[model samples]
Target: MIATSEISPIATLSMQISAVLVWLGLVFLTSNILHRFKQDPELVRKVVHIGTGNVLLIAWWLHFPTWLCVSAGVTFSAIALASHYISVLPMLNDVGRKTYGIFYYALSITILVALLWDRFPEYAVIGVMVMSWGDGMAALIGKRFGKHTFVHMGNKRSLEGSFAMFVTSAIVMVIILVLANGFRFRDLGVVIPVAAIAAILEAFSPGGTDNISVPLSSAFLSYLLESTL
Candidate 1:
């Protein structure tokens, strides 16, 4: 509710073109890689879930509003969170290769609705975008070259990777905030507290699903910051 003015239709439309480009690049590349590994159709759908979903979902932020943006975001995450506790969690113990992405399908649908709603679509888009790029890159880079991990169980995540994601996400958030004139670096005394919250949200998310939390939380936090400042 802090800064819900609509961005220029042309400018907003521009992110859509980029969204398509992101989709094409992610699909072709991920599909080719999965083919090399001989992944099955189910597995392929899952991969598409992350690579394709991340970009497309994030790209939706080009539009800005109040209810539409926040609702789509809230519902998407609520579904995902629901599925996790109800449908997905029960199956987690089954122990299979393609186990992770199904519950996310529910989450994705919820987020998709959140993104399209006219009232707050822009905020939804920004949150989704940050989670997409920030969380996705963290996983990719961590797997490839994560020498120093912070946690043990998923030694999969690393300090270096998290730092990368935190910085990348915050910088983007700053841009979103800046152009809107909603808030500025100068206003928040120390932006790290806010930025750190964003980073930690992604770092601790289930299966890189911070795509749901990061933006919604950040938007709310940013809104809080806007008023307090």
Candidate 2:
């Protein structure tokens, strides 16, 4: 039944048209972004390989059970993020730079799958925020202004980038929560704490692929807090 109450012609058409335009832009602009790191073929391969799977996985998260979906998504991403240490840990060269893209794809897809399968749409948005906005900012800032170095768990990373990631990720999560609640920011009870925990993970995680870990870890931490408090 095509209910008149559910249909807004202008709004629907505008959103559809805008979505199409955004898709087209991404299709073409991806090449330019790839070109920036064209000299690094291995990195490109890893990025493309991971991205291929990740994007598809994320798209499938809209139909799952809420809590379980997010929990599974977090678990999957945590595995991917923690996997490298147990495997042949590589150097954080351009190779490492590209590694993040793959990690992002993997974790993003995991969460997306969880969202779709578990009907946990809330976590899906959270996952994407950590991946796209948080991860992206970390790398960009790390490359541009990262000078202060720190070693943790046998990994070399920067404090400046850590701060950037923490602030950016927290802001994104908070903004998402605010907007999700119709700008009623006061209703953000546990989400605010969860976002804060996520920021801390963003600042301290040595995975180099914090994108992979952030969403999954945040989700799990959310579950933990919800259970205890």
Model 1 over residues 72-121: C-alpha lDDT tens digits? Answer: 44554565566555653332223233333444544644554454444444
Q: Each candidate's lDDT (Cα)?
A: 0.54, 0.52
lDDT comparing candidate 1 with the true structure: 0.54
Off by over 4 Å in 2: 1-28, 33-104, 116-119, 187-192, 203-209, 220-229
The residue ranges of model 1 lying beyond 4 angstroms of the native Cα positions read 1-102, 105-119, 152-155, 187-191, 206-211
User: 60, model 1: CA deviation in Å?
Assistant: 4.9
The numbered model that scores best in TM-score is 1
The candidate that wins on lDDT is 1
